[model samples]
Target: METALIEYGNFLVAGVTVNATESTDFAAVWDELLERVSDEQKTATAKLQKVGVLMPDAADEGFTYTAGFIVQGIPAVAALGLTGVVVPAAMYATVLVEGPAADSIKPGFEYLHSTFIPEKDVTPTGVNLEVYGPGDVTASNYRMYCWSAVDGVESPI
Candidate 1:
């Protein structure tokens, strides 16, 4: 349960975006998105790493989910039928979730919101990031870093 405070730079991401609620099945959503972009992703240049951007929905209890890949610059998403998101630079509290991603994300998030953030006394900026690098995602030791944006440092949102 180690947590770290770090600075994240603004970056560009391109992927499938969907409005998700508490009842939504994340695995299904990701599978659908992957099916839509699998081919392009294999050939896409400058595509850095996989990422999941969670932007809180002020109008609902859920968040806007963007299953994407960080790109070196503006990505040509029009042809892929994907949306481009500009993740603003901000300070974040991060936790490394180790294990199969499907099984670890929820618990990781719970820890962040329930214990870590409260202990640090930082206000979440309503934006969260899940970063994944190249690896065997199904491996038991797979890792994903969850970053929660927090107030205090100046951000260019």
Candidate 2:
């Protein structure tokens, strides 16, 4: 498969999330977070939007990730203030991950970091974004778009 380096201008999002060292049970966790969002909708300052992902340092330390984004354009601070969740505001280079949500995209990510990126002489710049769309319809129907920024790529005009 071929991969391209591109830029995402900006986005505004908010939600709740958790972090786990063991591979996460995303389905159950996402559902629970959504429930919290639904119940708190009336008091929320920003709209609850889509789900996302953040990679931890290779060491996999405790509470290394976060969930939620605020309404005031607070860069990467999650609105819910979960222990590890923070919002990220920076340019990113993304790729679409199709197929099962479990490990289907691992190879792609490996290839991007190991092969494509080095060949292009670029370093990772911003947060890696995992954009979840309608594909979460079923256990096997999961689809997520993964993105990472070129170390020195500039913001779009």
Candidate 3:
């Protein structure tokens, strides 16, 4: 489990995401969101990524369920106009998750939030990010690389 700290610029993302744990169909939601952005001719230079604490409902108020965050070349101003969401800029800690993106990724996140964070004695300084790489063709198989920023030095939790 290798970890690294990196700086990411601002970007825009439009997606239909739910806060509750009612077994959401993320694939469908992601497709819809991508379509909407495409229709608007939103040229996304930054790839799609997911970020948030594992079992967010169990975390404190600020921490919660999975939230989608995209990193694009567009600046904050332009991104806000396009996505209608205020995205804050900051550093991030990145970690790669191998295997299927469905349930497997959740365990990785859980480890980060529950075990790694406390073990490392670090707190999230900026928005969490999950970089989705190749292998997401099927529901049962995919790869997701996660990123979460922390104060001082950003490292994998």
Best by lDDT: 1
Off by over 4 Å in 3: 14-24, 35-82, 135-141, 152-157
Model 3, 1-157: lDDT tens per residue? 6555566655554333445443665555556555545433444423445443222333544332333445454464255333323345556556667776766656665666676555666787535655666444345556677766556554334
Candidate 2 residues lying further than 4 Å off, grouped into runs, are 19-25, 39-49, 55-63, 67-86, 137-142, 154-157
Cα RMSD for predicted model 3: 5.7
Ranking by lDDT: 1, 2, 3
- In the order shown, the candidates' Cα RMSDs to the true structure are 3.0, 5.0, 5.7
lDDT of each: 0.78, 0.55, 0.52
Q: What's the C-alpha lDDT at position 127 in model 2?
A: 55
TM-score for all models, in order of appearance:
0.84, 0.61, 0.57
Clashing pairs in 3: 50-130, 93-148
Give one digit per residue, the lDDT tens place, for model 2 in 14-105: 55556554476655665665565544653563443454556555455643333444344543334443323344555555566667755655
Count of backbone collisions in candidate 3: 2
The residue-by-residue lDDT of candidate 1 on 1-157, one tens digit each, is 7788788789887787789875777677667778877575667632568888898766857788888777655536655667888888888988999998878888888888888888878888889888775687778999888888988655445
